[model samples]
Target: MRLDERIVPYLHMAGLYHLVRLNETWFRSDESLVSAFMERWRPETHMFHMPFGKCTITLQDMAYQLGLPIDGNYVSGCLMDFERYIKGGHPAWMRFEELLGVLPLANCIDKFTVKCSWMQETFGKLPHGVNDATVKRYARAYTMMLLGTQLFGDKFGTCLHIR
Candidate 1:
């Protein structure tokens, strides 16, 4: 299999695990394992989004703060990965479930399964053929979901929020 093909399953599993953690369940048991997996799979680049209140930071504005060219391409790659996985289908889901099982979180199994259901539904509506537009939309949605979930978790005092 191609590298992309091999990685797709891992990505799907990671995505599902992420979704479960974001759903307000504390994966206390699997914390270390999850952390290790995240450290391995997460992008090396730093990502920051402006909070909803009392913050002013645009992607363009952040450039001055970082003193580096803030390329939007990093976000683009995230979305592209999602698109590629969706197009690849079953092997991706299988890999994702397998990875989810590696974590010691008990409740996570069901939560991750549900996340896969949501992803499948959302992906089914997209254009079968991949294109820049579809990828961008997927990326934007993914980013927004992350932001909203984090904010929600903070207000509710749940462990679901991204750290």
Candidate 2:
């Protein structure tokens, strides 16, 4: 299947570079309104607006949790398909596109992949437990957390500095 045709997982989505890039836009605008809510609303969990759901180990958090090497150059994008995913449709996705304004995403995304080799080699499954990505999404949170946090401090510098 084409890469974009496959839903990109948070596993590969929340790279430091990707998050930082996103936050660069997010924090400066009204998007910041969600920060306080995001932090306290559910607390360190993957979230979707409809069905009132949450995934404790959303793929984005897993990268940091698993101590996966962060690829600063890594390019990640959530496929801009929301009407089907959101029952009533929340504006976060649309707002996000607005926050981004515009970019050379088409040029960049074609070259991207889940940067963590171990994540792919070991996890070997698509994202789950949140959104349409699948249901086991939250299943690996605890185990991956235990594994990643143990090494995060030690490997953090490397992950951040690597590119």
Candidate 3:
């Protein structure tokens, strides 16, 4: 199999690769629908108060829509460790440099943020005969890109928090 094909197992293991295909046609945003939803959203009740009745989207709904595995516990990272990644001073940066083979310039890094486009352009393609460690790193870069472009996408949507 090709080297690019190797990353499939890693992404599949993480339950993310399938989401990439959704972007081909299934993924789309409707501003008017979003506005309508927002208009009826009740944060206090955590439900949508419609003229008919109040209802809420369950985890199952999200799982069904996004093809995410709902069986696993909610995964989250510690923000406290973010300070250690600043300015390439910490060992985490060293590990990143080792995996990616290059660090973004100091000017390009905004606190814990880096341009997702820069990351995609930099590590998007893996070198031939790369070791498992290198392939894992590429998988991680793709994961970050997927997250930044899909679920947690912000208005600007240009950069992602690297921490």
Question: Against the true structure, whose TM-score is highest?
Answer: 3
The models' CA-based lDDT, in order, is 0.37, 0.33, 0.73
Candidate 3 structure quality by residue, lDDT tens digits, 3-58: 26778898888878887765637567675776687788887999999999999999
Instruction: Please give the ranking of all candidate structures by TM-score, highest first, separated by commas.
Output: 3, 1, 2
In angstroms, give how far residue 153 of model 2 lies from its true place.
18
Model 3 spans with C-alpha error above 4 angstroms = 1-3, 25-57, 77-101
Name model 2 segments beyond 4 Å from true.
1-33, 43-51, 57-163
Two-way lDDT contest, 1 vs 3, winner: 3
Best by lDDT: 3
How do the residues 1-163 of candidate 1 rate in per-residue lDDT, one tens digit apiece?
Answer: 0112223343354343233343345433355654443344423333222234233346676445333345444533343344354434544435444433222234433432223224324532434466655444454334334444432222222223111
Give the Å error, residue 13, model 1. 22
Collision pairs in model 1: 13-96
Whole-structure CA lDDT of model 1: 0.37
Q: Which stretches of candidate 1 lie over 4 Å from their true place?
A: 1-56, 66-69, 72-87, 90-101, 109-163
Q: Rank the candidates by lDDT, best first.
A: 3, 1, 2
Q: lDDT tens string, model 2, 1-163?
A: 0112133343345432232222234444343544433444442343534345543444467566444565466533344543334435644434323422222233222221112333333334434344542322322331233233322211221111010
What is the RMSD, in Å, between candidate 1 and the native fold over all Cα? 15.9
Query: How many Å off is the CA of 92 in candidate 1?
Result: 7.1
Per-candidate TM equals: 0.24, 0.17, 0.66
What TM-score would candidate 1 get against the native? 0.24
